[model samples]
Target: MLVLSLSTVAFLGLAQLADASGSPSTGHRRRTAGGGQAMNLVRSAPNSNEWSTQQWGHWAKTQKSSLEAKYGGAGASGTGVQKRATGTNYMTNQNGDSSYFGSLAIGTPPVSYNVILDTGSADLWLAGSDCTTGCSGVATFDPSSSSTFRNESSPFSITYGSGQAAGFLSQDVVQMAGFEVQNQIFAVCEQVSGGLLTAPVSGLLGLAFQTIASSRAPPFWETLVTEGAWDEPVMAFQLTRYLNVSGVQTLEPGGSFSMGFANSSLYTGDIDYVNLPVTGSYWVLPITSISVQNQSISPPSGQQAYAAIDTGTTLVGGPSSYIAQIFQQIPGSAPGTGDFESYYTYPCDTDVTVALSFGGRTWSISPADFRLARLTQRECLGAFFEIDSGGSSAPSWIVGDTFLKNVYSVFRYSPASVGFANLSAVALAQNGDASGAVPSATIGSSAARVSATGSMLPKAHRSAGIKIGCGLLYATSASLLITIAVAGVHSVLL
Candidate 1:
């Protein structure tokens, strides 16, 4: 299956969600980034605790269309399952696989602009200095003002699941986290769909490999690493938790984006390195198996299952067949009605446990991280949707933030592998869980149809993603979803 990826700007990693635990690999040693430098990520967008039926339905619509545009349409919607312990949230921190925000300077003299670091797609784009559209109040870049800015003849345009962006290509120095990449190619987007560019965040810093790059230039992070800025070509993240719990929540506490090493303070125990397929550009890993509670889901004969670890993707999507299988095991779960075609809804209080393995170990997602939103007091949306990618070499699953916040994630380039570990008890203590006791559903009513509004994701947003193996780039809507932020170490299976 030549499966592509779908993503939000800040997503990915594993825990009990799939190798999100205490698996120790001797060769996997941890180190601090060169110069002890760490890239600080700011929390820019505010989260919406309110997710009405209309919003859920709209999410299903845009997400389904996004998938169909590439992986073909999915079957009828399936049921839902969940066990979170918190309130409503979108993909921004608070442990619901939310968007991550940070600042990086581009152009010769260096002008800092807020950007979202994404791992799903490969492109670095920012708002042009021109006033208009999405670039409104947010900071914009002026090509003429920078002495080192180089112009390219190529016109730049990218269409996402919800909106679109058009601009031109340019080259300049991109410096972030104390590391600088000279003459890095990026997009200076002039026109953007509304709601895409909000205050504090003006562009996307895609961390995916160059093969998928729309501008066809080397990625900023990769360039810095290969250029000998660091001995290890590794980038790791610990997204802050803002979901349920008591008292005031600090927006950016505990959440960090780092390069060349893992933060020991954020996670506990040793990290395990999972081997990835060398044949692909995006991060693709094999899944040993999946299960709902105690029931194991075996793929059809000759079928190979791979999960795309995308930090930029906000939601977790998989084959309809598998999603259906997952919900069938959870009682009181059903497909959404009306415009909610690809999403599933279930009793908010069901103690449903979903787990996945990648040959070496199995991991699980906390119930809080599994629940996307509440359509009603009794029924809520499941974070995992259906993307129906049923062919060979394609990714059967796109693992995004919903599963990422449960564990500390590490993406390394040299060996070309991904790793995960349990969040330290201290880190977990500060973050709250999304799986609160939402009113339990009365089976029948839980399956009722819900209304919809517009796409929750924004223009050129990389929040919810589905990346194809090779082709043109398609965009996804971006929004904030909050659930409980639970991080813990899993006992080694040995």
Candidate 2:
């Protein structure tokens, strides 16, 4: 599921689709802002989001840094009363699916700030007034100025694959999206290195569980759900698409990030719910099997191997062996050389399709998503990459925005689970124009491109809940419930 920060989850192992499986556990940093120009070629896309296939990768890299800190904790008591409010909260994505930012206010008067809505990690961190390295373009928070600020004095830090941030823990009246949490313990950076984050974003807001919070405190969103700030304990994301639209590199409306309830208008049909351990660390669920063009691939040990759904990630990665097996089934596919050593490339015109199943139900990904970037007139790089989720006990795959763009995603609490529903027709309206994506003029012609958006999908295997249930509202008898939607497109469309 999720670090998918959008979030990552460990897989225990898996049996056949017939067996209801469970079990297993396990495991970015900010980058300075500044990106290359996007290609402007207009081409057909499968889903609502349009990615930079020209980048030669999946929208899966941002969340990789935060995975190192495997901390766990429980929710602390809320500091103030609940503020039942709703308004338009916006997130910008100029670098394709690279990162997403939303409005978050802290302190008594609430100094508004922008943060990444990462479902991959669990701690809420932002640039502090005293921050050093890599603090160029982001707004900084001054703990001294906030009336509700409390100095915990405990040194706080999170290490990434290449960088780290050092600061102290502080509690403050924190507000985000539509809800606010009081005395929320968050990180205030004094020194940050390894090129953690760029401007246009102050920091990241983890939407995962409290179990993996680096601050060892309940994440801001979980606090809202745990205290019944809203009706249902759920947070959903409908990340739209766009890439370097109109030469603008930042502040473009990306999609919707909802809390408490799921937005019905954003999706269609029943929200196929994938159950997760309520006390689990990440928003992860089990995948019975994965297939390419109807060809099947399973976890090596036959155990429950999970796919962490991370929004911060740019590309999707899996065990090398399984990845190799997958490409072997695709004709003209081969190992890419240098720079792309672990990647695979296939015929530029190949309309490849990949399908995955949870609880016996299957959903297929669009072909435009499969082919990451074009290498020549006839060859292209694949979006799927090879990543070892550390050890065998960890997730075998990390599912990022690449796969999420094909469906509407929901992460629920209480009877913990994740929901993946098909997109509404309205949402898929611009599939050909790449919807949210604005291609740069450099992408050449669509004549050399490939897209399997119109390819036939594998028959969906039916499970009881597979085709049953009322669209993201699966028996909301949890004593509480609420619904929210930002704007549409230029605003929050969910």
Candidate 3:
């Protein structure tokens, strides 16, 4: 994520004004041209634009070094931990208009805006008063009266997997979890094109590293860091699937946003860190090999594709060629007869495993993770199609919840490393110590059973043709269990 210096002159002017009369100004030096001071009178003028530009250049270098030291070195070797806790929470309704779903009573009653937690792209934007009928059931964020609102009128636009939106920039007093983010720069999309307006979500809360943010705007994460609200420079997440019926839509204020160092007891061993390519502004993880059902398939050479470890995306997407090769490996897999390009279908009950190799580690995914949920019966549908051939040339993959549920994922932006720890290993290590260990139970109508002894050894669990290795043992019921294992450390069940 190379951050190009935007306008050297503009930055220099700002820095000069900020440092005026503060110190002796000892380090400030004049630039010489042709082995002589170019226009000695102008060059010596401290407030001249050229003089300020030189000062800015010196300060910019210092700022970069300071930022690196505070955040971490550039690329995957840097280390930082998320200041907040990470855990799974449920949405209340599917109708996309609810902005404030849950409320938190702090100095004033704070509302938990129904924000789409996205990791694919970095930007924290919400709907403003300019939003009209697009929001059906959600509350709109009105910035007109906020004392902190700063209307820049800067034009902004964002395109997503489904659609795009264009709007103007404005500053507002944004509050979350009792924390006030003052004069935060946000986008107010007056008009949105794409069906996203109809989804159950109201706005998007980007949680990705600040490196991959809109070129025109500073990211919400950066604002938080600049405000000194958090001590750590990293953030972590743990997403759970198939919560109890009563737990669905459980959006109460101050619920939980778990983040901390990886729990050692939750995994069988230490977490593995892998290096990735940091080119341009994206972090690209090279795929050493991709296999299905244990058979390896070769992808096009010199065609390195970067994948964003996105928790918001529900399905995995990648280059069409790569996806085709993967689906071809499945015994009964075939292309769908429709406009969809890379979509393929296989026998409903066929057992398959998709394995992806990255950074010397091979992470295998279960068929259930690849299967799409059908509108009826709630059964596994099929593998998600990756459409990368059209206007989109970037061979990127968005690894969603299906693949994430099996591992505990640690997203350390400070070091730019993604760590995976298998959940099965964690569950078995803590089976029954009166510390919320998972119990042996059966999930689904199938006769599959999950047995854990609460130890660091591996345990097996089977349900509906899906076989999982449980490592961490915490709590269990008829269909689900709170177990921990490596891959990061996650609770797993049906």
Best prediction by lDDT: 1
Question: Between candidates 1 and 3, which one is better according to lDDT?
Answer: 1
User: Lowest lDDT 10-mer window, candidate 1?
Assistant: 485-494
Residue 255 of model 3: what lDDT? 13
1-494: candidate 3 lDDT, tens digit per residue: 11110000000000010011011011331112111100000000012112222232332232222111111211111112223221122112111101111111101122233443344434455545576534433345566545445666455554322223556656554433223343445556665532333222335544444444442234444454433333343333333332111222211111112122343333444566666566333334666678888898884444445554544333455566788888887776776533333456677567678887666678887665565432122222354455332223233454544465456566555566667766545333321112221111111110111111111111222111111110111111111211111000000100
Which runs of model 2 end up more than 4 angstroms from their true locations? 1-75, 79-88, 243-251, 298-304, 430-494
For all candidates in order, the CA lDDT equals 0.51, 0.49, 0.35
| lDDT (Cα, tens digit) per residue for candidate 1, span 130-179 | 84675555667899989978886466665543345667777776655444
lDDT accuracy of residue 214 in candidate 1: 56
* Residue 170 Cα positional deviation in candidate 2, in Å, after optimal superposition: 0.6
Clashes of each: 59, 64, 48
- Compared with the true structure, the alpha-carbon lDDT of candidate 3 equals 0.35
Q: What would the per-residue lDDT of candidate 2 be over residues 1-494, giving only the tens digit for each residue?
A: 13112122110000000000000001011111111111111111112123333323321232222221121111154333333322223344434344444556666656755555566566677778988775654578898888878887676655433345667777776654335555677778777653344443456666666655545567776666655565566767665554223332233335555665666766888988888633466666666778999988764444335666666554577678888988998999998764566778899778899988766479888776676556677877787777644443445566666687788888888788888999887546633223343211110111111110111112232111110000000000111111100000000000
Q: In terms of TM-score, how similar is model 2 to the real structure?
A: 0.72
| Weakest ten-residue segment in model 2 by summed lDDT | 18-27
Q: Which stretches of candidate 1 lie over 4 Å from their true place?
A: 1-4, 7-35, 43-48, 67-97, 244-254, 299-304, 390-394, 433-494
